[model samples]
Target: MNQKHLLACHERILPYIHRTPVLTSRWINERAGTEVFFKCENFQRGGAYKARGATNAVLQLTDTQKKNGVVTHSSGNFAQALSIAAKNVGAKAFIVMPLTAPKVKKDAVKAYGGNIIECEPTLKAREAMAEKIVREKEATFIHPSNDEQVIMGQGTACMELLEERPGLSAILIPVGGGGLAAGTSLAAYFFGTHCEVWGAEPFSVDDAYRSFKSGKIESNASTETIADGLRTQLGDRSFPIMKKYMKGIIRVEEAEIVETMRFVWERMKIIIEPSSAVALAAVFREKDKFRNKHIGVIISGGNVDLNNLPF
Candidate 1:
């Protein structure tokens, strides 16, 4: 998509989503040796930035499409987002979720009015189930991260960030299926004065990093990352945008992810998910690069299972 698309998306989804605040921590700045601003999407509607994309995609649907409803396969944030977005517009949402997904997430989806269809905890199964629902229900499919409208909607988070902190030198976002990373990159390119965009990925599931270096889409052989929200692979739509706009991807270890998550909780007193911590861990991993510079970090979500916290 282009700048105009992103701007329109921000306006279209404004009423449906929250303009989450940008927060900062003096201690965090000292620890990283950089001035850091955090765009807390953890505080966003549905407890994640996925709300922006979901709301945008749902709102753009025609009456017939809305009547037919929307269907998507998501294990977490996007499931809740799509359900809530559909409910707000008086539409039905059929969500295909893995049986292995956290109970809390599934509950959230149900609470938001989604009709959950359980599938095997595999991408193939999830996709098959979603496709079947689309055929039988004649529903529209709204991809969590790969759709152009979703990408533009996700960019609005960074657009808001830039509007509040125009002088940011750079922004770091966690890359999963590459929605937020791609969106943030576009936002920085269009809105920032000279802001650079970077991505943080788990070494356990470093498909985005591998894809960036190899100049093609890459798949993960294993999804063994604690940053559950970041286990997905990049799609055709988001990959090209991120490849063209992102500066680079920094991979962090599982331990680093947990440590950063705990650090943010204890120090910033904010409950951020491991996926969100990935971006901050990247900053700590390469502290020298961002030293004395103004950096904006996107906290992607806060839908963590408290009972299973690593720290």
Candidate 2:
């Protein structure tokens, strides 16, 4: 997408979403040897930056489409985001969640007025259920991170971040389906004076990392990471943009992810989920490369289950 498209989306969704805070920690900076700015999207509506995309996607629909409603599959943040966005736009939302999804996320989705449909915990199962809802109820399907509108919407977060910190040398965003990463790259290209976009992924679910190296989409054989929000593979729509604009992907160990998660909660005094912390973990993994630079870390979400924290 172009800057004009992103600007239009920013304007359209401004009244609906939050301009989440840009935060920093002296301790973190000292440790990482860089001026790290955390885009605290955890404070965003529906408690994640996914709200930005979800709202934008729903708001971009036609009246007839809105009347028909929307459908999507997400185990956590996106489910709540779509539900809330649909509610704001006076449309119905059909959420297909894997049965293995955390109870806290499932409850949040229901609380946000999403019509929950539980299915087997597989990508195929989730997509099939969403399609079934679309066929039976005539709801429009909104892929969490693959739609063009959704990518433009997701880019708004990076746009805001760059607007607030134009001199940033680089940006680190957690990669799952590559929507946020691809969107951030567009924002950096259009808005930043001299900024690069990078993605942070769990080593256990390093499909994006593998994809970047292999020059094609890649899949993880197993989802065995604590960064549950990042288990999904990159999408074809976002993959091309990512390959073109993203500098690289940094893969961090599971221990590093958990440690960074705890560090943010304790030091920053914010409850960042494992997915968000993955960016910080990745940053710390290559401190020498980032030394003295201004880095923006997009804290993607804070939708963790307190009852089962990895720390």
Candidate 3:
């Protein structure tokens, strides 16, 4: 997407999404030996930054499309986001969620007026269900992280971050489907003054890292990670943007993800999911490289299952 598209998306979704706050912690800065800013999307609508993309996608639909409604498959955050966005626009949202998704997320989707369809906990099952809904209901399918509108909408978070904290040396974001990473990298390229963008992924699901090295989109061999929101693979729309704009990808272990989550909660006094912690863990993974530099970390979401915390 171009700068104009990104700017238009930020304006289009402004009324639907929250302009989440940016936070900083002296303890975290000292530990990382850098001035780190946290773009807290955890406090956003639906408790995630996905609201930005979902809202943008829904608002752009034609009248006929809105009447037919929208369909998507997501494990959690995007499901809640699309539900809330659709409800705000008086459109129906059919969400195909895996049976293994967190109950809290499922409840949030229902509360937001989405029709939930549970399926086997597999990508194939989720996509098949979504496709079936599209055929039966004549609904428009919005891929959670693959659509052009969604990617532009996701970039607005980084755009806001740069507006608040200019001159940042780099930005670190968690990579799951690569939408947010691609968007963040584009925002850094267009808005920041020479700011580099990096991605963080769990070693258990390090497809983004492998893909970066191989110069092609790659799939994860294992989905065994505490960062449940990050278990998906990258898409065609997002991969090319990431390949061109992202500086690198850092892979952190499961233990590192858990420790970073707890550290943020204990020190920053904010609830961040494991997916969000992946970014901070990357900074810690190579402190020497980022020493004394101004860095921005996008806190992707805070939809944690209190009963099943990794800590």
Models 1 onward score TM values of 0.99, 0.99, 0.99
**Poorest lDDT segment (10 consecutive residues) of candidate 2:** 189-198
Q: Would you list the clashing residue pairs of candidate 3?
A: none
In candidate 2, position 163 carries an lDDT of 82
Tens digits of per-residue lDDT, candidate 2, 1-311, equal: 79899999999999999999999999999999999999999999988999988998999889999999999999889999999999998999999999999999999999999999999989999999999999999999999999898888899999999888889999999999988988899989999977889899988999999999999999999999888999999999999999999899999999999999999988999999999999999899999879999999999999889999897
Please, what are the lDDT tens digits per residue for candidate 3 over residues 96-126?
9999999999999999999999999999999
lDDT ranking from best candidate downward: 3, 1, 2
Whichever of 2 and 3 has more lDDT, that candidate is 3
* Candidate 1 clash pair list: none
- Clashing residue pairs in all predictions, respectively, total 0, 0, 0
Q: Model 1 over residues 170-189: C-alpha lDDT tens digits?
A: 99999999889888999999
Q: What C-alpha lDDT, on a 0 to 100 scale, does residue 302 get in candidate 3?
A: 98
CA shift of 302, model 1, Å: 0.6
Instruction: Flag clash pairs in model 2.
Output: none
